[model samples]
Target: MLNGERLTGTGRSKLTAALALAFLGAVTSVSGTSAQSAVPKPGASVFTTDIAPILQAKCEACHRAGSSAPMSLRTYEETRPWARSIKARVSRREMPPWHIDKTVGIQHFKNDISLSDQQIEKIVSWIDAGAPRGDPNDMPPAREWGNGEQWNIGEPDLVVMSPKRVVPAHGPDWWGDLEVDPQLTEDRWIQAIETKPVGVARRVVHHAGTTLIQPDGARESLSEFAVGKYGDIYPEGAGRLLRAGSKISFGVHFHSVGEELPVVIEVGYKLYPRGYVPKHKVTEVNVGVINGHLFDDLDIPANSVTRHEAFAKLEKAARIISYQPHMHIRGKAMTMDAIYPNGQAQTLSSVDRFDFNWHVAYVYDDDYAPLLPAGTILHTVGIHDNTAANRLNPDPNQWVGFGNRTFDDMLQCHVLLYYMDDAEYQQQVAERQAKKKSQTTQNQ
Candidate 1:
């Protein structure tokens, strides 16, 4: 099923719908319980013992007070009222907001917040059992979180703010670039970077993309912030270069939110210790719609579902660190594949349910990150639904095309990777092969 409903589109869509149904069936069977059998017994005590721990580990990060989530789930009092909502969301695999399809493609990630099948079952069972508080002593210690003002990347070594802009109560979307000086005296390596719209600006800002302008006039994309994105934290031994005497530019996209508001974009950079240089420099590659063109022939008819495919060929051997699918409201799903020179193709990642509210970049674990040789082609297939079935669709009767506004449509994927020489690539491939063999043997 595509978005929990059968699709009556092309042959491929029918096949995808069949596969999705089969996958859901497999998941339900593997959990060793049917929907009726999975219901909890009356008066079962599950909240403090089973459900609380799961929430603490998975949900509380964002669902706690001062976080972005609408309500806090830190205690039974704060959570009891939302029990039914939680059950519905978790049963649909929509809560905690991890949208990557688990049945296919790479399964491991460094920052995966998705709950397991057993965890989902537990949450549903608890809610059905009346969401009891049970023994208070069984509750685990509360997880500590920084105040709302704290940066996600921890205390940053440097912080910069963009020039303030006033967004009108109602107007056309605004797009402009604002530049700020970092005033660095010496070169530094960036370990992590975060960008956010301050206060009420979060409601109006669609995205704030920061770029680094070097003293020599060269520019590099530093980091970006969307609604659901956290921050970019480079893996160990890899970092982005920040030259001395560099200025930062903020490319802000603001949409009116029914109230006039003044907005400022804040950027934070966590730096590597002085005198330390990273082995690999991280770079971002954006695979745009229909063969690398950002806004070329992206037409979606009213009340129809359309699919667009894009391809990018690598000029150098590289290790892909993350995959972030980008689209507007009409976006339904996206799948990324890597076609090697020898003609073998592998699906690296697939976001089956692409929610525009959550623009997450799934970061691969170091060992599982794809190592591709030069000439490998990255293929991306994005699906867009301009029909009433897409609840996020602003107007199903309006044909959508490429534009900067949220109502219009665009298709793209952001891939973060570090290029390497042929020798290093070969060595890494061999190491990965050996590691896989060892894992297989251990499992046997």
Candidate 2:
């Protein structure tokens, strides 16, 4: 259940959407009667309808013969023993790590693999109830995966590929900043964005991105204000600013993938038409913590448990349509709670575990996901554990802070939002519709 009352800011609902996105796309599911029959009973043939489809739709892409995941769940023989682990992740809403608001209107995420609640129940029940292998005939056909490993959706409108940066096969995992010249964009609003794949010696890449900033030959940027450890959440609390006439360059950070595979990185972004300009320029919000003097730096190690909070007061009220939750390895989870003056705290987003590498923008539904009221106070809380037990932990003993470097940790909830101009926002929607209609008519 929701922990508190509805929030009210000046921009009201507009602020809600923006703040909510600060969280990774994890959601709270409300259940009644347990509906406990979702999982299949044990002692049956786990065929197509029973299990193959689920694995294909959710696991095959990454777990295939030579891929990133640890093991492949391609065949029933391979999946049977590990059914327990699979069911666990699904029950926790972890697999198919998607981060979009499903309660909202008809919206699709650029990168989504989340299973429905019912589906999760089925997997769980099947295991608890004795994973019934229904029948071989019931099993659906297996799918063929491709080497391209592109988005499930084929062919984006535009593809901006970044030049490759080679990392020596052996080392302490080198980190460097590369400047990308976008050929030149005459002011184009990006509609969709992605990171293109480059061959690597190993999956050693930590994180890479296109930070829209001043083209003043800056290799990297610090947060808006670094407030020690606890307040590191708002290092760039106000959001990173992208000035006019600036080039969006790649921020490349990688560790040797595996053995000696050199690292190469590429970026892909699709832009809106030249005429369409969002009222608000690009802004990426980070709502994590900074270490404080009150705590011992050594005690607050990388994977050691820690806490922090931050706030961003909006000057103009605008509704946010989408956002992204991000954190380095040490970060366990995060929440962006909008606290009203009346003490109401509404959950904008809460991601329990964040994957720094696979970050993407998320657009919420129309109704459930909207803006917060103006005058709303966006408070974000971040949790981190800089410890040796952390699988992705780089350095458990080192004191951590917010930065683009690997050793340093971060707590950020970045978002892409637009000003709430009823006329202009709607006009852009209409223009998009008209363009679609005209193109359809011409094709027909």
Lowest summed lDDT across 10 adjacent residues in model 1 is found at 27-36
Question: Whole-model lDDT, candidate 2?
Answer: 0.52
**Residue 108, candidate 2: alpha-carbon lDDT:** 49
Return the TM-score for candidate 1, rounded to 2 decimals. 0.80
Q: Per-residue lDDT for 239-347 in model 1, tens only? A: 9988889999998778775678899889999999999989998987878753446576788999999988888999999999999898989999999999999999999
TM-score of each: 0.80, 0.64
Candidate 2 per-residue C-alpha lDDT over 1-444 given as tens digits, one digit per residue, 9 for 90 to 100: 121113333242334323342331353321222312234444533445756887887777666655544457887656655554555556656566664445533344433567878777767666554455555577677786655435422344545455666666555545565655555545555544445345442255545556555557542232110000001111111122333456556565555433555555554444445566544553444443322321222125544688766666554444555556666667666666777556787777666566544454455554334455555666666677777655466678788876656556666666554444556545656665787689899999
**What TM-score does prediction 2 earn?**
0.64
For model 2, what is the error of residue 424's alpha carbon versus the real structure, in angstroms, after optimal superposition?
8.4
Candidate 1, which segments miss by more than 4 Å at Cα?
1-45, 149-155, 164-188, 196-209, 213-221, 225-230, 243-247, 251-265, 272-277, 440-444
